[model samples]
Target: MARQRVPEGPTPPPAVQKLRIRYAKRGRLRFSSTRDFQRALERALRRAAVPMAFSAGFHPHPKISYANAAPTGTASEAEYVEVSVTERVDPERLRAALDEALPDGLDVLEVVEARPGALADRLQASDWVMTFRGMPVADLERAATALLEQERVEVTRMMKSGPRTFDVREAVVSLTASPAEDDTCAILRMVVRHTTPAVRPDDVLSALRAVAALAPPTPPLVTRLAQGPLQTATATVADPLAADQAGDGT
Candidate 1:
């Protein structure tokens, strides 16, 4: 066998700073897959002239890390990504430039210089809101109560490998249903922990159907309201980038 010669070249510059960005997938953009967002972001970085750090390999790619992306077909207000840059950049300036470069539906809400800890470690739980049109609040409340009463609720999801069944009850930190302002629709709010197999909002809905025979007339509009460290006492999600922001003295 003939030996292949290794290509020699100068290595890419080392990353000087890391930044954490909080962005939203709203409107029609929520339906885009993770790969779609990744490509869009890379393009935006290039168009915005961001000083992104590249990997030191033959096919070098930008060093961008995504943490706990929301499922496709669902809107989210708390999507997060971290980027390494070859040159230090002002977080706000970078955010503005990228936001302008990207499409309108994908909004950049905030950015912070990363601290020492990993950003993924802080995303312990997520808060979600599901809106069911033409469904009465009373019915939703009953279903939520039934689901909460259950000791265990299992749901199945089709994975790439095969059908996987998992218990969603343990991951549910809080679940509540109330009437929307219109009174004709119902809103369900839930807090779920980031667990193995990952209990999604759809999984909770499946559990509701199994436990209380709750089925909406129309597809529910699901949106992730928050994703961060869970505040035990308040049963709410705190900002994941707060530590980084504080560290940066911003």
Candidate 2:
């Protein structure tokens, strides 16, 4: 039996989207929050005239997504952001365009274009460098030793679901401290959970306060050593801890 067949039109080609982007951190601008960064980035993208994809609506804005944002006031050498555009563009040209529009301190190191539907889990980990100044060498050693001694150190986490506790040990895949060659303060290198159960410089600060007696009630200085995997980016130091991570530049 031949049923009446309805004619179907040809399938429309998938819309090509282009994302011109660069990652940035708000150092000493912690008050700005993640929303602030997004606003600034969108503004920069439009100002740079980078081709962008916009959602259809009365009021529309370019399509952009930030990978993972660093906490404010903490400088990071590495970060990630993804942008979407309607047209394909060269990475180098896109980089140059964004660079011109961005101010000093904000840099676009790479502009690689990824195809739609591609898995965004390409990034693995981020390296953070913190300075715990004024902590005596003895106290610094004790805190680090205590951290490494146990298989897991339960740390309370603040979540919308309510207060949750997680093992900082498992997340802290690597940790180390050393005397700087040119500086008087101690250098701490840490790689903690990024995707979930995110840790910050303040956590380490808390540990130092608890375990070290000679340590200061407050840190003298703090800086993000580097963020993102080592292979895709550079590191602040070339120590053994960072080498343990599969993706961290060995």
The C-alpha stretches of model 2 lying farther than 4 A from their native spots are: 1-22, 26-31, 57-59, 115-119, 160-162, 211-214, 225-250
lDDT for predicted candidate 2 compared with the true structure: 0.60
* Model 1 TM-score on a 0 to 1 scale: 0.96
Looking at model 1, the pairs that clash are none
The model with the greatest lDDT is 1
Q: Which runs in model 1 stand beyond 4 Å of their true positions? A: 1-7, 248-250
Taken over the whole model, the C-alpha lDDT of each candidate is: 0.93, 0.60
Worst lDDT run of 10 residues, candidate 1, spans 241-250
Question: Per-prediction TM-score, please?
Answer: 0.96, 0.74
> Taking the candidates one at a time, how many backbone clashes does each contain?
0, 9
